[model samples]
Target: MEAIDGLIHGFGVAFQLQNFAACLAGVFIGNVVGVLPGLGVMTAISMLLPLTFAMPPVAAILMLAGIYYGAQYGGAICSILLNLPCHPPHAVTCLDGYPLTLKGKGGTALGVTMLASFLGASFGIVLMVFFAPYLVRIALNFGPAEISSLMLLGLLAGSTLARGSKLKGMSMTCLGLLLGTMGTDINTGLQRFTFGFPELDDGLEIVALALGLFGVAEFLKSVNAVAPVSTSATRIRIADLWPSRSELRTAIVPALRGTLVGSLCSMIPGTGPTIASFMAYGLEKRVSRRPQEFGHGAIQGVAAPEAATHAAVQGDFIPTMSLGIPGDAVMALLLGALVIQGITPGPQLITEHPDIFWGLIASFWIGNILLMVMNMPMIGLWVKLLSIPYRYLYPSALFFVCIGVYSVRSDMFSVGTTLAIGVFGHVLLRHGFHPAPILLGFVLGQRFEENLRRALLLARGDLSIFVTRPISLAFLLTAVLLLGAQLYFALRRRDEIQLPPSASPILDE
Candidate 1:
């Protein structure tokens, strides 16, 4: 009943002219952004954040939210048509999507992806509507100690579970925590790590950091990479875009299974759409009678991952909104945007500003419908978008990166800061380190520190406070278990590598 009433109020808010227009514009831009290879949702949102300073909080948030999920719909286009996964989450789609294109069933694959994406997103949105309100109620009971312990769990899980070497992810996370400490200390009013620079008092701009690491760093790496060429695959007919009844029957079950996998992954920290999509694809292949057809244009291959990506993308919002704990870099930026708007996320946010909370939820239904329309009838328009040359696209994007950075403080120094960070980020990429964990750590570190200090002060400086409370103790134990399991796996894999070839079980087989 509470959800129903809140949703009713939310629809009223969402129906306003400004909010409606914002949602439309955001989805449209996100569609274009996703179709482009180098420009990711992170870059699009970071660049556009400054521009939303004057917009109403509800409208701004609605627009930004649209971009996040809207990109999911657009991401499948290039993967199926050009064998290019512009978004990392869509990379799994290329395994089967491109194969479908080679077999001249690209349009059919896209039809399945569209159906799966809608079904997946709808399932995720319904989960949020029912789950987030209850989650917020439970989170309200968490004291500083519990919150601190939970955040520690989030940090550790994010680092260890990220798609890379655990050691490297941990290193990047530590670096971000160090960066988070650079600004003035709120409790003591004493500056730390400012290096005598006045701007460091505010620490690095979130916009600058996000644009530098994701936006400019990706640009630097992709600048020299060859652009995908158009082939006969681009000549897909509109009539072929609709799947046959047989193909639809083949896709339905896998799409549902993928949605379930995605919803589960969304609830877990550090496991985002990229991981979920791959997991769904692997799961489908394992369960299928025709596993041999997985990489060679299986319809299940196209349906499962695409559904998982959409479901996970929508489900990512639940933790960010209810717990105020972002699951990934993209969610971190959205959290930052809310903070900038003077709207604190977490349990209090839903109660204090029900309009923003429910309105955002309502807008999801609207945005996803709009995305379906655009992806279907306008498929040709996006196919044409693939022909854009990299040379013209990147330089133009870099110019906007600089401009967006400059717009924040009206200073050239911020722009320079972005480029410097970008250069370093590119260096990290070259060395096989991901910058995503860095953003997650940076965003969560200050909150963790603040809660730790508060819990310590309340407990009269006793470190045992974290273990005394049952919730806090449970969270700590979970983090320990997670870390231990990861280390055990790492060691087991290492030992397997060290085994002599003749002594290996495979040799006996």
Candidate 2:
């Protein structure tokens, strides 16, 4: 009954004219940004965050949340039509989507993507509505030791699961933690890594770092890439938009499976949509009767990953809102936005600010509905956008990146910091180091340190308090188990590779 009443109140708040306008504008901008390469939700949000400083908290959050999820809807458009992914999660869609486009079934593939995305987002939102409150209740029982342990687990999971070498990921995470330690110490009044800069008192600006690492770094990469040339004229007619009954049937089960996978993965901090989408695609391929059809335009291939990506993104809000733990870098930015608005996110957020929490939830549904309605009709528009040359697009994006970072503090130092970070990020990219784990580490580092100190203080400087608390102990054990499993699999793979090839003994046997 309490949840029901809260939702009803949320509906009332979301239905307000100003909030509705904000939602519409946010989704519209998000969709447009998602259609364009070299610009993503993180960049868009970072650029627009300063503009939201004067708005009401609910209205500000509603808009930013819209952009975050609406981009998922838009990302699929380019992946299916142009073989170009606007976001990392959409990259999986390109494997099957482009092949389908080449087969002259682009319209069918896109239609399936739209349907799957809608269904996936709906499933995730429903899960969030039910599970977030329970999670918050459980989190309310947690003290500093448990919270610190949980954050450590999140960091370990992120580093271990990130693509490429775990060592590199761990290294990046450590770097991020080091960077996070800059500026004034929370417990003590002294500065740690300020390097004598007065601007470093508040710590490194998150807006500057985000714009540099993601926004500017992405722009630099795009600038060096060859502009795609469209030689053949691909016309998608309205008549070709509807999927055949058989195709629709083929996509249903995979979409459901993807939704389930995505919803579950989203609850885990540091796991994002890209992992969910890839996992969904891999699962579908493994279980299908014709695994060979995956890269060759399988409808299930298009449906599953697209669904999972959207669902995973929506599911991320669960941890971000309920436990004040961001699932990924994008969610970290959202968390920062909340703090900037003077609203703290945690277990008490719901009770203290029901309007913000419930209103944001209600707005998510509205934003998804708006995305579904906007996607199909605007297909032609988005497809047209793909034809525009990169040379034209990147410059405008770079301009925004510079201005956004500068506006954060009305200082040139932030812009210079963005440039430096962008160069460093480019170097990192060249060396196969992913920026996600680093960003997550930086975002959570402060909280982890704070809680660690608090826990020790509470326990009279005894480290055993972490092991003595049941919740903290459980989280640490889970982290150990996960790390052990990863190591075991890695060693097994190495052993398999080192083993000598079987000789003619098999033939003799």
Candidate 3:
């Protein structure tokens, strides 16, 4: 009943003319960024952060949240029409989206993706409305021991579940954790890794790091790559936008499954849309009656991942809002924005700032509806954007990256830091390193260390508190189980590879 009252009040706030307009503007910009290759939600939000400094807190958050999910909708356009992903999560869409395009079903694919994204987002928002409060209530019982252990689980899950070698992911996570420790220590008032620089005491700017890793690195990579060219030109009519009855039937179940998977994954800190999308695709493949069709224009292939990614995007708000813990780097930025605006996110957020909490929730539904309505009509426009030359796009994006980083603190140091990190990020990418885990680690590192130290201090330097507390023990045990599972799968794969050729009946035959 209390939640219901708060939601109603939130709707009242979100319906205000100014807040509504902000929501519209955010989704509009987010959509544009999402349609452009190499521009991710993180980059878009990071670049836009400085602009939000002067806005009212609720309106600023509503707009930022609008951009976050709006990008999820826009990313599908490039993935379907150009065999390019505007964001990392959309990369999975290419498996079937481009194949559908090749088959002259691009319009249908786009329409289905839009619908799936809407359904997924709606489902996630519903879960958020109901589950977030409960999670917050539970979190209120947590001590420093539990918080520390929980953060460890998040970090471990992030590194272990990321695509590619777990070892490499862990290595990147360590790098991020180290980077995160480069500021002044809260307890001692002493700078740790500042190297005698005053600016360093405040810590490395997240905007600089995000722009460097995602924007600059992407710009460098895209500049050298061949621009994609459409092999055929076809004007899709409105009549062609709807999928066939059979295709719709085939996609329905997968979309639902994806929504469930993504919503659950979003609740787990450190897991983001990319992992959710891939997991959905993998599950769809496994359970599909005709798995062979997956890579060759299966309707479910496009539907499942699209739904999962969008759902995950919305679902991330659960942890971010309720526990004040960011599920990913983008959420970290959002949290930072809230903190900058003198708003603290946690269990009390709902009680103390009901308008902000409820209003933001209401805006999510509105923004998603706007996305659905706007995306369908704008499909042709997004497709047309592909014909624009890469050279033109890259320079404009680079300009924003530089300007955005510089604007963060009105300092040239951040600009230099972005450039340096961009070079370093590019090098890492060239060597098969993933940057996502690093960002996740950096975001959670400070909190993890603070809580760990606090817990130890409270326990008089006894580490057994972590094991004695049921909640802390549960999180730690979960982390161990996850790691053990990864090792088991890795060893099994290695064993299969090492088996003698003669031991295989197919080879012997």
Choose the strongest candidate by TM-score: 1
Q: How well is each residue in 350-413 modelled by candidate 3, as lDDT tens digits? A: 8888888889988988998888788767677776766678878788888888887777788898
- In terms of lDDT, model 2 sits at 0.86
Q: Report how far residue 203 has shifted in candidate 2, in Å.
A: 1.0
Clash count per candidate: 0, 0, 0
Candidate 1 clashing pairs, residues 3+ apart or interchain? none
Question: What's the distance in Å from true for residue 110, model 2?
Answer: 1.0
Runs in model 2 deviating more than 4 A are 229-232, 496-509
> What TM-score would every model get versus the actual structure?
0.97, 0.94, 0.93
Residue 157 displacement in candidate 1 (angstroms): 1.5
CA lDDT of each candidate? 0.90, 0.86, 0.85
Query: Across residues 1-509, which tens digit of lDDT does each residue of candidate 1 receive?
Result: 99888888998999899999999999999998888888889989988988888899999999998999988888899988888889889999999999998898999998899899999999999999999999999899999999999899888888898988999999999988888888899899999999998988988888899999988998899888856557545877667879999999999999999999999999988899999999999899889998889889999999999899989988999999999998888898898899889998898988999989999999998998888787777888888887788988889888888988899899998998899999999999999999988888888889989999999999999999999899999999999999999999999888888999876654321
Q: Summarize candidate 2's per-residue lDDT along 1-509 as a digit string, tens digits.
A: 67778788998999999899899999998898888777878879878877788789999999999998888888887888888887889999999998999999999998899889889998988887788899899999999999999989988887887778887888888888888999999988899999899999999888888777887877777677746746255667666778999999999999999999899889777679989999999899989999888898999999999889889988999988988888888898898888888888889899999999999888888888888788767777777876688878788878878877777789999999989998998888888887767777888889889999999999999999999999999999999998898899899778877766772222321
